[model samples]
Target: MALTGAASAPPRLAPGGVVTRADALLAALRAAAPDPARLPRDAGALLGERAALAGLRRNGRIAAGGRARLLCAADGWIAVQLARPDDVALLPAWLEVDPARFEGDPWPALAAAVRDRAAVPLVARARWMGLPAAAAGGGSAEGGAPGMDAKPPLAEARRAGDAPPSAAEARPADGAPPRVEAPPALRVTQAGTPRRRHAGPWRVLDLSSLWAGPLATHLLAGLGARVAKVESTARPDGARRGPAAFFDLLQAGKESVALDFRAPAGREQLRRLVAWADLVVESARPRALAQLGLDAEALLAEHPGLSWLSITGYGRPEPGGGWVAFGDDAAVAGGLVARDDDGAPLFCGDAIADPLAGLHAAWAALGALRAGGGRLLDVSLAGVAAEAAAGGVDPRACVVADAGGARVLCAGRSARVAEPRARRPAGRARDLGADTTALLREARA
Candidate 1:
């Protein structure tokens, strides 16, 4: 289903039509699954899982989750996500304010600081400092125009040693002279015969935290994959501090193995766990894992039948690989925000990018596995949001005002703009490290 048009005020779900898109992808996934019943029936509903638990709502300049805000800059609006304490701590530095004077909440000071600054420089500075920030409507540090068409690809994949085509080497689809260089959206890093050998459920080693990665693996688990989630003993998933039901919904069926990455024995156990899986899912920056001596390329090379799914904010490409992002800001970077009556940007859903990326990542991982593993699937939150926005609003879709607020009418079917709902957890999620000892003992055996 498409979002309502511009002639009237679009409902809160207008901008990305992400729920509709996710529903389509989910349907395709179920069609390809060995057991269609294993997958969830409503992809659109999954997008609102977190909101359902957190009780979030759509606020024009403020994100539904209330952690990110769209503040005005001298040139345009920019989204700054203070989702973490570290992000809040960096505010004084980001705004060039005196730490001694900065007190209480940072939003007022932040809003005042950026009121006279240009968005491009502010965004560039925030990214350099590792803050999750982005210009409204897809503007970047490179000065790209703010529009849906100018947004970067939802995700780009590349093999080792691959580079963007030179202008001279590129060609337009219309058979005209090459105007600009562009990198391929996806490329097979390695080819292998399709591994139709499904003697048992696929084993998945999940080394991701929070929403995107965990949600992907959770979906895989729902499809009968045996998933083992690995978390650091010192730093368990931050989600544990949030709503219990939300955390349980994403982690219900997985075995938890907490390891101390700083210790040699722990790292060894991690390597063994990696060896034990047919697929590995992670969301760390490209270099973060390499620093831990767990490189994707090296692991893929060693395990020719392994499939690795890497979820990131931007992607693994050079400059973007170094940037930090969260769901709200990343959605802004992807041009996925709804437009207000004055054409200003508004946060559409509750950290919408996370679920969108999660769904896409799960789908991509399954495809790679079906193709016989030996591949790295790089899925980015911003990239997926951009792709969703690229589909544009469906002209046939319209919003009908009703006594209960608003309902979206599309293709002769109407759905109410209701509160997001959570799914029943398949089972209780195991405590952190609950399976570490047993799994490690089995690995040794």
Candidate 2:
């Protein structure tokens, strides 16, 4: 009954002309499910990239609009994310200028500074400081150098005090090379022995944020998993600051555990909680998790049946892991960006990567869970976007129109999708730290 009455309803969004491949995605999930009946029939009902984005907007959109956008640097374009207050505070360091120079808004000064600087060094430095910044048009940030086909994984997050892997020594091991030099659409790696457990209740630790990861955990909740959303007191999920309804829509049935992730006690609690989990859902790059001592390999080895799903903007474990990206940029990375008549890229429907990745992650998790354990699913947003795009919009499902020299596509009959109701169990959502004490005791016990 984890999610029986937990899900109320998603706000109705006027169909955006842009169509989502929701049907294809859902079909793929259903096909992959080892036990289809274990999944809610309406799994696709609450899905749609645009609908998810609409849930996050304020009045009409985010008050902090353009917090993550492509900025014009002196030599090229760079994507900088100033989503959190800490990120805002790091701008002065990123720009190497006075924080008060912008008065209150950092946009103008940031624009000027970025305009006067080159993208590469600015991106590298921003990442070195643990701030979200990346080069646009396939430029590299922390993980790999510019123009590389795949992002190489960094052994550790290249924060201000950390060291990045040396280019000379970061070579593929001697023997057979990777199957693909470029990121693969889907990659599944597992270790240890598989042990299947069919039970009435399962435990999941959700360490991801934003749409995709949250949506995956949400689906698991509907599937009868007892999901505990693990957040850091220092930086809770950004969704909390967005409209409440949207937050509730995806998080209604999950418990919240806000711990000081960096502190000794918090870290101890995290270890216990993770050890107690049947599955761990996270969207961090491998290095980020390494920094927190949650080594996937070690964890899988320690807990033979533990299934860990690592979500990234690109693939993980090397050549793609360390790279930086977000939902929109990852979709663009996947080549779904709308283009003008001149073939210039235009923004597509609401951060499409988020929802697509979410669905894919949920399906992957279910498969891993069904397989029993010792499964590590590395899901990349860009890779998923590429996977969805590889299917392409069915020509029969769309129509093209030309406007002022710009070409656009509109959804047709094939795009008219529906969300049918299912008998999901009733459940409740918890507030920040609502179950910390009880969970800590359980973990310890």
Off by over 4 Å in 2: 1-21, 30-65, 73-76, 95-101, 115-125, 135-148, 151-182, 318-324, 390-428, 440-445
Worst 10 residues of 2 by lDDT: 1-10
TM-score of 1: 0.85
Candidate 2 residue lDDT tens string, 1-445? 0100102212112211123455565666656555557554543444332344344331111111345655665555555667667788877766657778756887778777767565555655665566665444432111111232454223234433454333222222432211112256457878645765335577899999878899888777767788999999998998887655567767887888999988888888898998888889998888888878889878888887888988887777553566666776565555443322232233333566676788778878888887787888888877665555443233333222233321223453212223222333343357898999998888787
- List per-prediction Cα lDDT, in the order shown: 0.72, 0.60
- Give each model's clash number: 1, 12
lDDT of 1 at 86: 91
Leading candidate by TM-score: 1
lDDT (0-100) at residue 159 of candidate 2?
A: 38
Position 18, candidate 1: lDDT: 71
- TM match of model 2 to true structure: 0.70
- Give a tens-digit lDDT track for model 1, residues 1-445: 1122222344544454577779887888787777887678887678887877877656666877788898977666789998888998987776667865457888888888777776655676676667888877532221222454322322233322344332222112332111111212233456333444345788899998889999999889867788999999998998999888989888988889999999998898899988778899998888788867888877887776788888888777765676788888887777777765456667767777788888888888888877779888888788787777654555666667778867878899988766577787766789999999998886676
Which portions of model 1 show Cα errors greater than 4 Å?
1-10, 138-188, 191-199, 395-400, 409-415
TM-score, every prediction: 0.85, 0.70
